[model samples]
Target: MANTPQSKKRARQNERRFQINKARRSRIRTFLRRVEEAIASGDKSAAGDALKAAQPELMRGVSKGVFHKNTASRKISRLASRVNALG
Candidate 1:
C-alpha cells in the first residue's frame, strides 16, 4: 500500500520501532510482575528489592517513550506505597 519510496521507508521504520517498543514494554511488564510476586509472597524485603529494580526499568521505559512519564511515576508511587504498607 506504500506506493511512494518514502512511504515504504517509513513503513519499514515504523515496523522496526514497533518491535523495539514491544520488547521494551514486555521487559517493563516483567519487572512489574516481579514486584507483584514479591508483594504477594508477603516478603517486605524482597518486595522492596524488586521495587528498587523495577523503578529504574519503569523510568527507562518513560525515557525510551515506551511509557508516559506520569504513568511510570504513578506506578512507582502506588508500588512504593504497597511496599511500605507491607512494613
Candidate 2:
C-alpha cells in the first residue's frame, strides 16, 4: 500500500533491514546453541570456550537492538554458571 514514492522507498529499506537483522539473530542463535551443546556434553573447557565466543555475540545483539541488554546479561550469567558447574 505504499503508493507514495517516499513510502515505497521506506518499504524497501525496511525489507533490507529485516533481512539483515534476521541474519544477525540467526547467527547469535547459532553461537548460543554451540554453548548449549558444549554444556550438554559436560566438556567444561569447550563450554568455557563457547561461552567466551558467544559473550561478544550476545552483547553485539544487545548493541544492535536485536535483544535487550538485561536479557543478554541473564543469558550470559546462566551460561557462565553452567560452565562453571561443569568443572
Candidate 3:
C-alpha cells in the first residue's frame, strides 16, 4: 500500500518500467531464438546473418540495463563460435 503521494508515484513508475523491461527482454529472447533456429537448420550463412542481426539487439539490451555487458559479450562469443563451427 503506497500511503504517501511520492510512494504512489514511484509504484506507478515501477509498473511502467516493469512492462517496458519485460517487452525488451522478450524482444531479446526472440532474436536469440532466431539465431538458434538458424544454427539448428545447419545453414551457416543464415546463422551468421542472424547472429549479426542479434548482436546489436543484445548490446541494446545491455545499454538499456536489461542485460549485463559481460553477459551480452559472453553470449555473443558463444554464438559466434557456434556459427563458426557450422562452417
Candidate 4:
C-alpha cells in the first residue's frame, strides 16, 4: 500500500499511465494484426499497404516508449520481408 501522500499520488499516476499504455498497446496490436491478415491472405499489394499504415503507428509506439526502438525496427524488418516475399 502507498502510505505517504506522495506515494499515493505516484500510485495514481502509475495507474493512469498503465491504462493509457494499455490502450496504446492494444491499438498497435490491431494495426499489426491487420498487416498479418493481409500477409496471410497472400495479397502483396494489400500487405504492403497495411505495412505502410502500420509503420508510423509502430514508430509512434516506439517514440512513446510502448516499444523499444530495436524491437520496432525488428518487427518492421520482418514484416517488410514477409511482404516482399509475397511478391
lDDT of 1 by residue, 2-87 (tens): 99999999999999999999999999999999999999999999999999999999999999999999999999999999999997
Candidate 4, which segments miss by more than 4 Å at Cα? none
lDDT by residue for model 3 over 5-72, one digit each (tens)?
A: 99999999999999999999999999999999999999999999999999999999999999999999
Clashes of each: 0, 0, 0, 0
> What C-alpha lDDT, on a 0 to 100 scale, does residue 49 get in candidate 1?
95
Q: lDDT tens digits, residues 1-87, model 2?
A: 999999999999999999999999999999999999999999999999999999999999999999999999999999999999997
Runs of candidate 2 with Cα error greater than 4 angstroms are none
Instruction: For each candidate, give its TM-score against the true structure.
Output: 0.98, 0.95, 0.98, 0.98
For candidate 1, the TM-score is: 0.98
lDDT of 4 by residue, 4-36 (tens): 999999999999999999999999999999999
Cα-based lDDT for every prediction: 0.97, 0.97, 0.97, 0.97
Residue 58 alpha-carbon offset, candidate 4, angstroms = 0.5
Q: Pairs clashing in candidate 1?
A: none
lDDT score at residue 70, model 1, on the 0-100 scale: 96
